[model samples]
Target: MAGKGVFEEIIDGDVYKYYADGEWKKSASGKSVPIINPTTRKTQYKVQACTQEEVNKVMEAAKAAQKSWARTPLWKRAELLHKAAAILKDHRASIAECLVKEIAKPAKDAVTEVVRSGDLVSYTAEEGVRILGEGKFLVSDSFPGNERTKYCLSSKIPLGVVLAIPPFNYPVNLAVSKIAPALIAGNSLVLKPPTQGAVSALHMIYCFHLAGFPKGLISCVTGKGSEIGDFLTMHPGVNCISFTGGDTGIAISKKAGMIPLQMELGGKDACIVLEDADLDLTAANIVKGGFSYSGQRCTAVKVVLVMESVADALVDKVKAKVAKLTVGSPEEDCDITPVVTESSANFIEGLVMDAKEKGATFCQEYRREGNLIWPLLLDHVRPDMRIAWEEPFGPVLPVMRINSVEEGIHHCNASNFGLQGCVFTRDINKALMISDAMETGTVQINSAPARGPDHFPFQGLKDSGIGSQGITNSINMMTKIKSTVINLPSPSYTMG
Candidate 1:
């Protein structure tokens, strides 16, 4: 497969280079990191492990390019973004294959991610043209005392350079979610793609290169975060940050100091089921939301809070659905694939053991082969068990029985992470009430917690994240409003 020259545009031999100043350059550090295939447990490719000095060079290039990129007309920027989107769509298959090999993402979903990223870029381009500024005329007669005339105009301006950090899951889609918005808003960007997902992201960056964005406007740095993370975030060259990850985001926020930050962090999304809910529909969503992508998603249903009256029935339906999921390699497009790494698999195993020791009942026999953990459904998951409150980030779904709507709301609100939550019921009034009380960024009345079919307002409350992210919100976050005021000379009154 390596000899086929599939990723030849972005990769040289077996190693991918870091992108800076419109060129793919080898690292001066003389070091590289292996990208392992989870299914085969083999190193499929390598990416540069750059030095802090290399990061400083990228920062300088981005800082130098910011004003020029921001000065470019908004229409031209949007046009280039559209072209990049087209390039991404044209190369979807190869990029998706890279995702499958790099991160164990199922083939079908990886294709969807690439296509969705293209659509997101296209949408951001369209929205960029519609970001309206404001003009207002003020009169002192509105106040009681003086006669004066004032006129004000306000417009959004780019916040210089934006540092984007995307997680391994949804690599293409999430990376574009940051890049396109930052570009459309007239800001230069420096992307730090996750180590496991860097190859696919670099391919995406290559699309932007084909689109003819100004040299140095978009750069990608690949390496261990511990080596260059602080230097990137703390550097004055970065004007704003848009990050999607876990605890790393918190650490970045502290080190990033006063620079603007838009983060989409960890989630412990809850699924609350009312007694009046449709058992069949509830069960289907639970399985799909909890186990899809092997439950690596931040918005994946982490816990199910069902009314005690209907807990037993819901568990039976959910278990039946889980039994039907196919488990195998991503090459075959199975429903559950091996997780990204062995340590992640070990962490999940620890959670399972903790639940078992504390009396949580597993519906199926526990099974694990290396990083491939079969789907697990735990019942009677008491609050005392770690599985009830902790996010497993694996194919483990815990069912916690609650007696009433109030009890469910209380438990959901008490959680530290609040990215999203869902409630299933036929009662519209009850659904509306729960939606209002839930402390999450989004509430699904009868559906599973998801990021989007459209880029609506997605965010988190407590530790989940900071700021809002959607098409417009993200653009707004990366730019700031600058207002110009003019005090008009007192008008000479002509007798009329």
Candidate 2:
């Protein structure tokens, strides 16, 4: 697995790494899968895949090690995470290229994902140390004559284990948002990254190992999601499941049954451009949000709702912007890159075709090559259109026109997906009204909707997501409250 010229930089400790319980081991099934780069469709490397039985063994190891891991002082745990962050920074270049190769990310966006992930890990690590909890007495002898102090004060405490299922588009950032906090809060994790991005993710797992965490405390099992996903979700030992994707997140919710389930499903996010908004800025953000990461982000804007007063001008300008976008290999810094999988592109194109047949106007041809779905613009769309309500998760935007801001807000709320929505307007009253009225987890005004810093709570309303994620909320979500109380004796006993 190492010592080759191309892989010379990877150390023995970093390469051929395995799930550990203080020692490295092979998959019980002796089954392994070749990790592929979906962009170029090349096999990058191979990793061990756990059978259902092997999953149980890893879960057992996690359960056995949880208490010991939890007992370690909080500061030391924090320090280890900080070390992991340093290691990620040290390995950022190799990791970035790996992500671009696996997922076909433009070099710049690839760097963004890798670096942002390291920031998340480092942020969670520092936060874990500086924060803790204590119980307080409500009333005591220090209180006035007749009353006794007896309440409690506390902070977030870790759950035993969190199993994370990350998506193919964002191999590192999304998973780190879950894994970093779960670890910082002192919980063990078992990760199942998409088969395509497994190599970059495994390299990251090794970084955690190098950071000084003992084996099996933080582990991975890579294979088909169908093979081991059900086991991880339903396992008695998995106290929590953190998932990121579309229908898969919903499926996990079903299998989770009684376990605590946290999901970031999908969103039909919209960018509403009012007549009074700046044409240049609105057009810029529209293309940036809809096409960045090739439009694969859960937060990526999918629908553009424009007012008739400005629809024609806006459409012309936006089409001009879209036309300027270069669609080709990610290695060439193309404006739009290939979709993660061929099936995914096919799925999105079907939706676009449906919209076109239903009377939506097309501003450009929907291009497809191998697995890549090039940018496509659909205008004159109606809220009743399926493309308007469902997450395309591709480079297709269904543009609709409404009479007023109220109507725009109505259209935004019409979808079952409601992760995040953004409005472009200088009208403070209208902006305030939309931000307050829009039924979504986050509302952005004059900017594209996006996943921000690790400290802010990341979640959604309605079908978009359940529970929440972000540094603070994630710490709270991965932890449960346990009140500790102590009863004190009154100085004057009536019986005496």
Best by lDDT: 1
Name the best candidate (by TM-score). 1
TM-score of each: 0.97, 0.92
Report lDDT (CA) for all predictions. Answer: 0.89, 0.78
lDDT (Cα, tens digit) per residue for candidate 2, span 172-202 = 8778888987887879988888776777787
Candidate 1 C-alpha lDDT tens digits along 197-238: 898898889889989999999999998888888888888889
RMSD of model 1, in Å? 1.9
Model 1, position 29: C-alpha lDDT score: 85
- In candidate 1, clashing pairs total 0
Worst 10 residues of 2 by lDDT: 1-10
Q: How large is the C-alpha RMSD of every model relative to the true structure?
A: 1.9, 3.6
